[model samples]
Target: FINFPVFFSGVSMLIVVGVALDTSAQIESHLIERRYEGFLASGRLKGRYVR
Candidate 1:
């Protein structure tokens, strides 16, 4: 029974990571379709702080 918790935690971590990756990919695809930079764009670093 001691190993059960560890196993469950590992499974949950994997699920969370998978969901995050999938969500990011979807968002990136949408952005690209709209001809916009992605969340991880490596362009001029334009943002709220960039003047």
Candidate 2:
């Protein structure tokens, strides 16, 4: 059986990662829409419907 604290910790990490990803994507999209570079310096981030 898993320890209670360990299980909750894992779940908390997952939530944190999910929120971070979502927020970054939103920011990236906004930047791209305004004809600015993305968070990465290499190139623009590709979206599902846009380049």
Task: Please identify model 1 stretches exceeding 4 Å from their true place.
Answer: 1-8, 36-51
Q: List model 1 lDDT by residue over 1-51, tens digit each.
A: 455555569778889899999999999988787665444465554564664
Q: Candidate 2 on 1-51: residue-level lDDT in tens?
A: 765765578779899899999999999988786665434554755563553
TM-score computed on alpha carbons, candidate 2: 0.52
Number of clashing residue pairs, candidate 1: 0
Stretches of model 2 off by over 4 angstroms after superposition: 1-8, 36-51
Output the worst ten-in-a-row residue range by lDDT, candidate 1: 36-45
lDDT of model 1 at residue 14? 89
| Local distance difference test scores for all models | 0.74, 0.75
TM-score against truth, every candidate: 0.53, 0.52
Identify the leading candidate in terms of TM-score: 1
After the best TM-score superposition of candidate 2, give how far the Cα of residue 16 lies from its true spot, in angstroms: 0.1
